[model samples]
Target: MEHPHPMKDFLVRAADLPWVPQGSSNVWFKPLRISPATGSWVNLLKVAKSGVVNRHRHLAEVEGWVVQGHWHYLEHDWQAEPGAYVYEPPGDVHTLVADVDDPDHPMLTLFSIHGPIEYMDETGEVAYVETAETKLRRYHDYCREQGIAPHEIVF
Candidate 1:
């Protein structure tokens, strides 16, 4: 049996992707898909022990699945460990923290974001914004700086 449009399906080895720093020494991301049409993106976020992903609000829906280690939001009491799933509705603000005991294994989560994220300052002001396009540009910029050929992740 032959299936049509097989090329439309993407198979990626996540391990083969380079980790791009997220303006932090211990936080990085590996983008899997960047969809400009829907203003969405999917990526794996890695945070080392004691790393904080900062306080941010999602302008749209977002979902994540913990793939490695453990993490939790400072605003919430529950912790997310391996195999745990998380969902964030629009306008939900929270600060992500990774305080795992293991120093060698960082926390990794695969996230599917449907819109932009507003990084907030201490006074609740929007300090910066991150979107699918910005993430794509960041990946490319990191690749160029490291002398690595950028992969085509745009959809």
Candidate 2:
């Protein structure tokens, strides 16, 4: 049995994607999908032990699934370990911190983020804003600098 029409889809192995640095926080992200039309992006984010992901507030909802190691928000008491699912509502500002003393395991999580994330300074001012477009640009820039052809991730 064959379908009448061919499937219109994009596919790429995760191993083929490059891990682009997410600023100077000892964090990196491998972009899986980036949709400018919906202002959403999916990425696998990796954080080194004792790394800080900055204080940020999402303009829309964000979802995450821990794949390895553990982490927690400075504003929250509970920790998210491997297999843990997390949902962050819009406008909730929090600082993400990787396990402080875990030398063996760094935190790795897959996240589906919608809209832009505003990184706030200590004075509560918006220092930077990251959006799907910006993420795509960063991925392209990183791949270009590394002399690696970037996989098609934007849709």
Candidate 1 lDDT over residue span 1-155, tens digit each: 77773447677778778999998988999999998778999999988768788799999999999999988899998999999999999999999989767768889899999999999998999999999889998999999999998877887
In the range 1-155, model 2's lDDT, one tens digit per residue, is 98896556888689989889999757999999999989999999988767788899999999999999889999998999889999999998999998846656677899999899999999999999999999999999999999998898887
Distance from true position, residue 101, model 1, in Å? Answer: 1.5
Poorest 10 consecutive residues of model 2 by lDDT? 98-107
**Candidate 1 Cα misplacement greater than 4 A, ranges:** 1-7
Alpha-carbon TM-score of each model against the true structure: 0.93, 0.91
RMSD of each: 2.7, 3.1
Per-residue lDDT of 93 in model 2: 93
Q: What is the lDDT of candidate 2?
A: 0.91
Report RMSD for candidate 1: 2.7
Instruction: Assess each prediction's global lDDT (C-alpha) against the native.
Output: 0.90, 0.91
